[model samples]
Target: MVLPTFVLSAALATSVAAYDTLLNFHGAPEVETRTIDDIHKAAVAEGGVVTLWHGGDEKTQQDALKEAFEKRFPGMTLNLTVDISKYIDGDIDRQLSQGNVYVDSVILQTLQDYPRWDQEGALLRYKPLDFDKIHPGFRDVWASWYAVVVFGWTNIWNTEKVSEGPVEYSDFLKPEYKDKLVFTYPNDDDAVLYAFDLAMQQNGYSWFENLLAQNPRWVRGTATPTTVMAQANNSYAVTFTGALGLAPTAPFNVSIPKNGFFVTWGQRAAILKDAPHKEGAKLLHNFLLSEEYQSPNNTGMWSVRKDIPAPAGFPELMDVNSTNPIDFERFMADRERVERLKLFFESKIGSAQGLSPLVDDL
Candidate 1:
């Protein structure tokens, strides 16, 4: 499906943002010269604050990134908060609706909000350098959004508990793992929803139906399943490509499926037209997508940049097509259908009390 028209405008804006791209560099490397640091100082001079709302309890990582980014742009500072997940619901909508839109940029799943935000004209369009290099699906058709990182799915098993990892997504259903498999609450996590959505779209409805029938206990937070397995709560778990994903201190490894895998990008960044610090927002926007910040040793993310090598120890997925951009008009047009799927999963997999808060609002 084509992305929403808002994305087209965003893409256009991105293409034309070169004049918007700024730097006051004069000659060679100076005694104390880091462009990012100067940009920070400039923002402070302009009374701008860089605030980002994101999902995932990645405080240590965000704090480190902020310190690093600010060090580069000494005057600039990013106040990052892991906000509530707004992927399939109306909280993000309400924020934009009530005119309480203080958030400058964010990193949330885009399966639902993408085209809708585009339709609402809530985004600023500016492509980072090398925007052309990203794989097709992650590119917002119109450039309203570009992926900063793409994390794929894998069945993570406790190395000490299970000798060999599940070779495919379906392997979780084997009687050996019955009632033993655990996964993130799909209804709560847009990442998990997208994974199961692909299982239905790419494999078949029956395949997903069967996979769920095995009775994997769905729980809150993306990292919970992995932690359970790492703690030996169960022999196996359906989680990110590997244990190094988030809870690196946990004792386990990831196994990517061979036939196909589910890949999702988190940490997509964008600014709203009304963002208080528009210039500061743009500086962070450009920095998030730049390899200078997302170096090869990045402790997080699957870089969308084709030029960058995958981080030091990530396992390669066999089937790696990114999610195609959805048509905003069509997607927003059929919001009910998407909401229904979300509700159905909540009833079937996640806790009624835990997930109802989000599903009811959606």
Candidate 2:
């Protein structure tokens, strides 16, 4: 029996409406009802492929995540692409506007883009398993997006070169540290910029001027400064971002500021509404939030889940006196203020030079 084209269209619209009615707009189920095995079955039925555009300076950053996901679900495949979050977010916007979104999910440092995309109705509203266990500030009320990892920046120094490490931002400006400091260009990364802004606010603009007199080597990415210091090329560095457990040993040691604040933000992740493999994306999301992956031992950093403890040797995020995750989200949302600060920092330090850390492989 062949139905008329209008009848088919009407029936399809009705089906979509019926599906939409199943979802609650306000305070729905906090935890996902479906188990990981159930999601895996559905994903396999849908061809079992998930393509994710992860945000990072190096492609190898997500290797462990991809490996874990594929291993946990034997038939499932994860196609991962890693790049700087700023560029990846722009690409996502373009893809969405063109109605050609190819990626199923994105995990990015660009916190503001998630809310904007949700408003545009471009994000899926499915809550992953153990959603209730996630930190309230890290997950969306509507389940449109949530953070899977907590990332931050703090001070680090070469233990071999510096007998006394910095306890506060001002310590870097001391005479002994002169010609020994290396730092990422604050204007180049918003997280680093916010950290520097906090320092400026606490110590005043004159502090920056004094530090400038210290002759710090300027670099592009947050990781570069730490890498430079680990190589014994510099004695001090800031913006030691990413997994805390991965901090360099022997020659280097990370320092949390005792007097002033450092910056931390959840690396937000979301599934696109128009994704080609929705089931696969859902499976991947649930896997990320699962206990096996969120374990501090697996990630080497803080988990988004409140029930999970911080990695060894690190205090729980709330126990830290000098850092606030919510503040970073608010900071990213204010574009005008962020732009002004970026420009102001550029004026003081000059523009970032050389190729991006992501450019080497691509």
Candidate 3:
């Protein structure tokens, strides 16, 4: 039964395509239930170590996670690498393509990458304990990825410098706020760009032109703007991105917009299909979703689990005025539109300058 080489190749291609389609539709089968102790024991037998690539502005941002994980799983070691989400996602792609993946799992802000990676069969489809308890919008139907924490952006100001903080996008254009505003360069961060896009949609392009006239200081990451405000170097800033419950309230106040929407999204986490320490990765994911880790007192942010109440003094995500978590997910899915918005904002704010916030140490 000799077959032509061309025919063989065609058959193989079709088989591969079919397999990918199946994966896209149903994903990998779910793993059996395992306690954290059971997973930790298996992980220790495999390698006793797990490498995680965490997306954030600075290495210190993940210090808490690292410390907590080590304490919770005594025998297992967690190697944490912190970098900008954009850079980490590209690095993960390169690693996967080269078949040399080093990271066992990822906790990232780039929500769009998870589904694409799942389609490529790059994610392990293991649902952690309590997977069924996660908020509906925060977890995938296929169990490929889920949100470990919720993040958002709003206005913040130094109370001593500005007696009254801006309550809406239009308030930034006032004469009182001129030369007193700091902003993250929307071109440099998709989240910041999305926030800016919402502002323009509500206030119009003319509002942006007027904002430029205010002579606001521009920086590379959302955290930098909050830093500027805290130092009183700027009287006000937009897009104060941080864990909602953790934001300082002393000399500064973080405010949700009185009119129009602010931005919020679940920061997603997943285990890599080719993880070197598969058991360890599973343990990490499970721990992240566990109640002990997701407690409001511990994370200082809204829990992705529906049963957990919102942090004290903060309303449930749904009750918040003029905000939608799903909108940010939709925004990230449209790459072409996001790129266009980036360029448009760059034209108004100028290119982002200085070292990346990940390495800037500021």
Highest TM-score scorer: 3
Q: Candidate 1's residue-wise lDDT over 1-362, tens digit each?
A: 89899999998787544233223222221121246456556677767568877655233435766777677676576888764556413566777767787778766655456555655667665554556666665567566666666554555676676565676666766766666677766666555665676566667777767867777666566555665665644455444332255223434656555565445454455676577786677678667767776554664445666667665555332133433222222332455766777887877655523443223221
Instruction: Decide which is better by TM-score, 1 or 3.
Output: 3
Model 2 lDDT tens row, 182-271: 877888888888888899999999998998999988877766766676664435544334234534467666777778998888899999
The lDDT of each candidate is: 0.58, 0.82, 0.82
* Candidate 3 lDDT over residue span 1-362, tens digit each: 98999999999887776346444465355864878899999999998999999888867888898899999888889999988998899999999878898889998988999998888888888888898888889988888899988888767777778777777888888888887888888899998888889998998999888988988888877678767766744355443443335355677677777578988888999999889998998888889888998888887777888888887787887777788986788999999999999888777667889998877876
lDDT of 1 at 308: 70
Task: Return whichever of 2 and 3 wins on TM-score.
Answer: 3
Candidate 1: segments with Cα more than 4 A from true spot = 1-38, 57-61, 87-92, 98-100, 130-137, 140-143, 200-215, 232-250, 311-334, 350-362
Query: Backbone clashes in each candidate structure, one number apiece?
Result: 9, 0, 0
lDDT of 2: 0.82
> 215, model 1: CA deviation in Å?
4.6
Give the candidates in order of TM-score, highest first.
Answer: 3, 2, 1
